[model samples]
Target: MKKFLSALFSLCLVFALVACGSSGGGEASGGESEETFLSIGTGGTGGAWYAIMSAAGAALNSDLNLDVQATGGSIENMKLVTNQSADLGFASPDTAYFAYEGGREFDNANPDLRVVMAGNMMYEYIIVRADSDIHEMEDINGKTVSIGAPGSATDIVGNEVLSSLGVEPAETINLAHSEAATALQEGTVDVMMALSGVPFTAATELSTVEDVRFIPLNQNEIDTVVENNQYWSGGELPAETYEGQNQPIPGINVGSLVIADESASEDDIYNLLNTLLVENHDEWEKGHNLASDFTIEMMETYVENGVVLLPFHPGAEKFFEEQGVTLNK
Candidate 1:
């Protein structure tokens, strides 16, 4: 009787251990489940960045099994990703470089950021009253030019452009794009520098004003500016994009980058890039003209553009490799 009782006790202990082991395995499997939600940082309601990213996020959600959220604009977006408050966000190459290098805005940032993919090219145009005396970039000195809104990529880029021209923010009027347009139209502000996508809404509206015209930065000056600061590249603003303009305006082009935190797994980045480049191409094109610019050839051009300035995340590098393309490194 003693032996039989001891054997039953052992059998019961084995069953308890087996049950605990099964429970542990189940928990581990649950922990390894996929991340289902991602947030993208974009700009204000009327901005193209906001519109394009929002649409892309929705398409990614529906097609790639992702739950994408588009929140505020650039500065906020960079903060979200760097702080791990967001999964993905949009960044200008200049902003990305600043964030990575601990430059102006990211001087206090802890986690250095990187770029995942180059998405679009945005031009920084300075729009002023057509009759205003500000015919040259230098004329902005000591004038009430709107440098862009607070906490915006426009503000950052605008500041850089002004600084490149030896202009100081102290001499400028700091206002959001909308406010600048209103101020210019009201004759309260003399000029406004807005860094935005082509056919920018704010600039378009400003152009519609009977007295508003875009100020063209000289190509030689633009080249010199970009040469000194690797972040800015020379680009043209087609006059036809704006009202009452007959000539292309020389300006600076900054790249829009799709950025993610290092915490995002390789597979997640790979899947995101794959979905944007392959599965949802048509859907994206239908949403924005900028989407049409996203092509394999353009992707290659972005890599070759020599101004990315930020390190490509390993996952992005992997994607490029899979496509039989080598990164510029």
Candidate 2:
């Protein structure tokens, strides 16, 4: 009887152990592992930031759980990150600075915003029909123009450029990038301005079917804009950036940045950088032509040029440190 009872107890212990192992232990079973979940806020669907960020989310899906949301442009993205509704977001240097410092459009300064990395240049492209009599910045005065989506970085900065340069449009329309492109093609608007990366989808599609030209900003005027706005820089789109553009078009450029809330874990952000920039770079390149320009070297240039507007998240700082680059913050 004693032997029987002992054997029964042993069998029960074994089953209990097996149950515990299968029920609650975090060890991978059936090739499934725990995933860290995150969210990213990007620009409108038609913009480069949206495409790039969506590609990044998919590339990191194997390692982490991430959701990408298309929001209004830079200003709205920054707001989302600050409100903790988003884990990270894309914004221009100027918008990030204002959001962090509490000025232009923000109700209060959000000091919690930190940069994960500086991405591509958002070139200010003031596009017009090829045969339009508007040849220079001054000609845009008294003409119908689509600035950008309302309350976007493009709208604020575009207005600043025009206001400073003394070019006032007779009628200003605020529309999404793709909608503005359609309006321009349909001759409903005379000028469309895009603050986007190279090979912008709307601009590319617009150029393919219509004879288009980028209105050039005077270098001196651009210099003045740069001097007054610390985040703005004078940049040019090289000839052939688009099908119909033959000469380099001069305009304003701002650093596009990835920002995060201060509460995010360092390890998670570091792993994200590893996956997007190292492990799945090829897939990222397939996302957009602008992806090729998103590199450690490009970030270094932003740092060197003093365009990085906010402090770096600790995880990103660690990753950049490993690459022999020390960020300003």
Top TM-score hit? 2
Clash numbers, per candidate = 2, 0
Span of ten consecutive residues with least summed lDDT in model 1: 26-35
lDDT of model 1 at residue 51? 66
Give the candidate number with the greatest lDDT.
2
Task: Give the per-residue lDDT digits (tens) of candidate 2, residues 1-329.
Answer: 99999999999999998777665444455546666888988877888888887777666656586788877788888888988989998888888988999998898999988989879888888999888999999999899999999877778788888887888899999988999999998999999987888878888888999999998888788987887888888999989988779899888987788899889999889988877778787888886667777788888989998888688998999998898886895
Q: TM-score for every candidate vs. truth?
A: 0.80, 0.90
Model 1 stretches with alpha carbons more than 4 Å out: 1-35, 61-73, 109-112, 168-170, 209-211
In the range 1-329, model 1's lDDT, one tens digit per residue, is 99999999999999998777656432433355333556677665546676676667666744244434444457778888888888777877767766777767776754457678777788887887878888888877778877776767778777777777786533566676777788889878787777778766677676776557788888777977788777668998886887888889888888788788877878778877778777887887777777766555566777776766666777888887788765776
lDDT of each: 0.73, 0.85
